[model samples]
Target: MFVDLLIGGIFAMSLLPLTTGYCAYSYGRSFWLWFALGVFLPIVSYFILFALILRQQLDHGQRLLTEAKAILAEAEEAERVQREER
Candidate 1:
């Protein structure tokens, strides 16, 4: 759980600039507005990061499935060739 929080925190930190920029653009005149956003933005940023990471993981899983299928096919071919030699 610690690792998850650390990852989320790191991701949130990375988005700090963008969050601050948006806050400035939307409510720069109000000090309280920016302050409130600064307080809540990290959690939202972390969720966005987590979603992106999840998408990447899904893509990786698909690639791994393809590779696994290819490996299985090769192994079957090798076994068939070996049987034919006997």
Candidate 2:
């Protein structure tokens, strides 16, 4: 059972080349670049793809902060306009 699962997992990993190709295409990058790398280095290519998808913790927090500030600013402006019209 374990060996079967392992084999299946490896087979799924082998298909990363296709996923990488599609991702490259969607991102307007060179599909052949990742495709060839994945074909030649399946394990390394998996890590490469993983790295590409990683988001920095700081960046995520910063984006949330920026969005929150924008929302707050808009609400404040609406409140100020209501006060001025009265």
Which ten contiguous residues of candidate 1 have the minimum total lDDT? 26-35
lDDT of each: 0.63, 0.77
- What 10-residue stretch in candidate 2 is worst by lDDT? 49-58
Per-residue lDDT over 1-86 for candidate 2, one digit per residue giving the tens place of the 0 to 100 score: 99999999878866978778777666456889888888888778767766664543247885687679789999999999999999
User: After superposition, which runs of candidate 2 have C-alpha atoms over 4 Å from their true positions?
Assistant: 1-14, 55-86
Please give, for residues 1-86, the per-residue lDDT of candidate 1 as tens digits: 99999999877765664565464544223444443555677566445544544565579776687679789999999999999999
TM-scores for every predicted model:
0.33, 0.43
Which candidate ranks first by lDDT, i.e. highest?
Answer: 2
In candidate 1, which residue ranges exceed 4 Å CA deviation?
1-58
- TM-score of the candidate numbered 2? 0.43
